[model samples]
Target: MSNDRVLNICFHGVGEPQRELEPGEDVYWVTADRFAAILDEVSTWPVPVRLSFDDGNASDVEIGLPALVERGLTAEFFLLAGRLDTPGSVDSAGVAKLRSAGMPIGSHGMAHRSWRGLSAAETTAEFDTARTVLAEAAGAPITTAACPLGRYDRRVLSALRDRGYTRIYTSDRRPARSGAWLQPRYSVRHHDTPASMRSGVLAPAPLPARARALAVGTVKRWR
Candidate 1:
């Protein structure tokens, strides 16, 4: 495995959500059993893997943390600034627990909306205020973010770059260069099995599919 590349696997809520889910959000939640199994499978992979969890879901602290600890793995937990301490979500104390457990934190913005089109104020709220709030909770500076809903355009990317974001994570389902500013990740879905994950994520994507991914990324960067 080369140190120049990595496979970023992102996870969302696991087990039963404590709060009402957003419309179509259920697709991202995987069962605890399946989550563990997938982790076991990924453990055997030879390449370097970067694990991340989005949303400030309580399950992150309740289930996700313990599982990672058991496997001797650490993940970056991107939390929603607005959703922190809300019902069904991870609270400030939960963030503390994750930090104490040696997990790094990143911002998922104030609201869990798409980051494609926005007014200046919305940008400030999402990019500025959210980072401040999340940093306060984490007791550290937040210099990284994952695009909410996996949505971002050229303008959005520029805004993040302007703010000095070290790296941005996207749901592009592809391999990523280790030190790239923009990192593509494969999101775990509700129905995914360990075998399915291996075939879908760990395996090299076919030539046509890789071309499509490259084209899509180019468009997103330039659009």
Candidate 2:
């Protein structure tokens, strides 16, 4: 990694799911052992890495936080405002606990739905109201956001900017510019191991792959 670029590694649910998961969401869940192994591996990287946990799973506070704390690492947690206090989800106490532990809080929107082509009301709920609710939960202002379901387009990006978010995260699977307002992240999946993660993330993408990734991000921004 260069001084200008940093890899953003994001984790979803860790350990067993306490409640029902959204369709296809299970693929993102990694076992407790796997999570620990990957975290241990990533913490040793010579390059810069930014860690974040998305979706507000109860395991975030239960498994994610302790493991991170044990390693003396800190990460940002992006929570779903609508799911707060629900069974199997991170509750109010968990949010406060994470904050107390010195983890930054961000919003993953009100509901875990695609941020593309949303109705006006849906947009308000996801972008505007969600931040308000999540900020209240965090007991601090929420200025960063991640697009729900890794989906976003021109409208989505514009709305987020209009709302004055300082950092906007996306699952674009590419290393991000360190100071860019829009950050792309590589999401860890159930099948991802340290070796695979190293190849997929630390190793540079081929020319064609890099071009494709760039094109995809560009299209997403303008569409």
Total clashes in model 1, counting residue pairs 3 or more apart in sequence or in different chains: 0
Q: Estimate each model's TM-score.
A: 0.90, 0.90
lDDT of each: 0.91, 0.91
Candidate 2 per-residue lDDT, tens place, 13-125, comes to 99999999888999999999999999988887656789999999999999999999999999999999999999999999999999999999999999899999999999999
C-alpha lDDT (0 to 100) for residue 57 of candidate 1: 93
Q: Which stretches of model 1 miss by more than 4 angstroms?
A: 1-3, 205-223
Query: For residues 1-223, could you state the per-residue lDDT of candidate 1 as single tens digits?
Result: 3447789999999999888899999999999999999988887765678999999899999999999999999999999999999999999999999999999999999999998898899999999999999999999999999999999999999999999999999999989999999999999999999889878887673345445658778524421
Give the Å error, residue 182, model 1: 0.3
Alpha-carbon lDDT of model 1: 0.91
> TM-score of the candidate numbered 2?
0.90
